[model samples]
Target: MSDAPVRTLLLWCPDWPVLAAEIVDGVPATGPVAVLHANRVVACSERARAEGVRRGLRKREAQGRCPQLTVVDYDPGRDARAFEPVVAAVEELVAGVEVVRPGACALTARGPSRYFGGEEAAAERIVEHVAQACVVESQVGIADGVFAAGLAARTGRIVPPGETPEFLAGLPVEALGRPALADLLRRLGVRSLGDFAALPAGDVLARFGFDGALAHRLAAGRDHRPLAVRQPPADLTVTAEYDEPIDRVDAAAFAARALAEQLHDRLAGHGLACTRLGIEAVTAHGQELHRVWRHDGLLTAAAIADRVRWQLDGWLTGSSRRGGGGPARPTSGIIRLRLVPDGVIAQAGLQAGLWGETGEERERAHRALSRVQGILGPEAVLTAVLGGGRSPADEVRLVPWGDERLPARPGPPPLPVARDTTAAGGGEVADGRAAGRRRGGGSASSGAAGAGRGGAAPPWPGRLPPPAPAVVLPSPLAATVHDADGEPVVVSARLAVSAAPARLTVGTAPPTEIVGWTGPWPVDERWWAPAEARRRARFQVSLADGAALLLAVEAGRWLVEAIYD
Candidate 1:
């Protein structure tokens, strides 16, 4: 690396998410707006901050301070998308610019500054160009390094050469951008960055962890974060803006496909693969829709198009509609649609054949399945999750893709059984059939037989399970079904159903009768709660075909939760 000052200038567009929302809604840029994450305020417009609504304030507290504050959900992708035009404008001003975050970018200003006369002059021209192109209000700061420049931009105060220490001295410790150090400094009654910077580095590190060391460097205005790369990245994504809004999904998909083809060619020419992609759609009335997707391996043009299609489908399907009524849906009539590649890594090894055995095959399959499922709806596909809880049924959770993956709960070892096999009390494999397979099938038979003797059955194959009915309509129904013979049956806590064979299926099918029975297990959850909060269960049943079923009867209902194949 060159031992130069790096000649970088940093530009920060303040409250990017709020501004992006404004742009999307075509809302007038007036009054204060704040973006929220959970209950805390994450970002606020300058107008809102001036009104005494600052980031980190509790929602109720902020509202009390700025009653007129317009609140919106914090969307990082929207902020990033809205910043694209700003990046393009800056790139034209300098030889190169790198986005440091959704709202901030850094570029070498040496050449541009020289051509424009001085650092100050170049910064002014860059800011002016952006103001002319859009309604976004921003700040530009030029200094010897990123740290100094960022502070200068925020404070609009210039620091002379070698004066970075003095400039950073008066700023709050929070400016160091390390949450822990800032908190510690507050506890120690040190409010300013300079206060902590003056402390011995060794002492700071010992008490505050690595953050103390980082604070020391930043307070001194010495930034070690390299410029990343000096050239523009190779994964160029193409987008087209339509003059009129297009509401048809097919049209949008077609246009998106054409763009992806172009982007793929560009990537191929550079021997690169784009792993991340973003799609943006501007609706007729100015509502902006955006999506960010990732591919584990090299993403093909067709895959890109499919992703765009899914995003639109998600929006069109009203997945955003939660409660009965809210705001009307944005007209599908799309005004502008853009596709952008976020980053690219070399594709040199991606073409290596014999995709089997290597990890790449799994990733490819996952990508393909994800695309198909996206079109079909997420609930169409599911992944099994293992867990151990009082409810033998709750021990395993099945979650749809892209949703929060149910975490593995610490408990008994894997039962060595699937949905077809039955899990006895404490989640022990109790059935020998292992669901749909014959007793002599494979390596699993020995284990299944052992488990079955203990009342745990292997998951059965090919038996279609009734669609879990909602006893109360939309809400999940928890009902007990006494078998035809009125024997109390216990069901698995997890409502997992395997076909008589364990193949996954779409839609719901009728539940089959139990050919064999195995368990009368008791499960008690929420023991720490009041007695009324606790639950109990018993399970086991037999089918006509000699297949054993594990059923759980809880709260006086007989539900066929799982089967032993």
Candidate 2:
């Protein structure tokens, strides 16, 4: 029930993204290197930083500043793979190790401080152990809370007991990691954590929402350890045993993907995602090897699989650990693979979006689209919505992205009962000459009802029936529909057809024979306005090549409106 952050020790590897690039990709760690993501600098090596390249700089600007910079794309998998060895190394020296992210980890300091004689001694031992065991350099800090400890680790500082607030007070609001909130705080003259923390807690929650309130608590040194508060499900472990041992890296990767997917499926069934993963492998000689991988975000299936592959690659190749304190290399091929979730949480903040994509994926899309809008104009990006109209183009209206998706017209008008278009010997005619989603279809399954106007949806008159086309062209392509007598088929003002369509020619393509035909379903809209008025007859025709098309004839000109799959 305690609301205080436990006395914690944190280990941080500076510029771990760059270091990971080095460990996993063979990029030189001591060079002027920078990791670029979304055309922005995610992290820079010390040398690159010294060369005027910093995080968040545009990739182009960073290159301009450091001409010789080695650019690398940011890969979360590579970072986790490289850091897994470090987490395993730390666990050997301390219990209750929590991987805050790929590059940093934390553990309660009370026991370790006492066991090692003091807090500073425990920090020293952890730093030394990691360096010796994994050949990775890290800094350590001891503080009353994980939040403060993480900040302290940047400078290898130790905040005395009960003095965390003072230590965090002078830090900038940007340290909260909410860029927009920090910007607003700075504009409102709350530039530092101390000033932001002085606001009323209730007001912070009401204005900034839940995440902001959590940041406020961290600013006031009330950091709560999340991993310590709950127990993950124990039955989530997934394992795979192969008849043949996996000695090759490719074989190990193949096995890893299967186990990773199984593990993810089990966690998904519980509506949970893992933050910390335990991977255990058994060799033919009965020797067991295990490693832990952690991330700040939920580990996706691909990430879990990548870590498993990296760990197995290390074991089979005798690169288990650099120093003597790590696990010995396996003496034979791996016979069994196991994945255990050490830290699991509800899959909140990452729910699926409208398109069945994760929130993170949607966010990335939004950011990219927003960036494009910023460069071009907002109207450059548009989304389509279905509306009430007789024609496919009229039923769809394009609106600027992010705007309310309201249809331009009202709900469709009363529709006629659908009729089968299949005619015997009519040459493979469409089974049904209907319109979009079963004309007057029950509200869409995704948006269901109320997708039209707010209230009792308006009606679309002369609307076509169901069985929508697979593709609707933005602009109707010019085409010719003819009868067997080699005469052009035409629809008169009285809604009469001169002949049944027997051939169709689209664009510059040669005319193809039409086997079946339906509809002269006529529509006369906007008759009051001469310029906007439209009088057209629509048809569904099947061709000899086994293709179906939606055709419309207006003013003696035939147009291909859409095609059915």
Q: Pick the candidate with the highest TM-score.
A: 1
Cα miss at 446, model 2 (Å)? 24
Across 398-435, the per-residue lDDT of candidate 2 in tens digits comes to 97665567999865534444443444225444454432
Q: How does model 1 score by TM-score?
A: 0.58
Model 2, residue 124: displacement in angstroms? 1.4
lDDT of candidate 1 over 308-340, digit per residue (tens): 877665565444543433333456677777888
lDDT of 1 at 439: 30
C-alpha lDDT of residue 202 in model 2:
100
Candidate number achieving the greatest lDDT relative to the actual structure: 2
- TM-score per prediction, in order, is 0.58, 0.51
Report how far off residue 177 is in candidate 1 (Å). 2.9
Off by over 4 Å in 2: 229-429, 432-501, 504-565
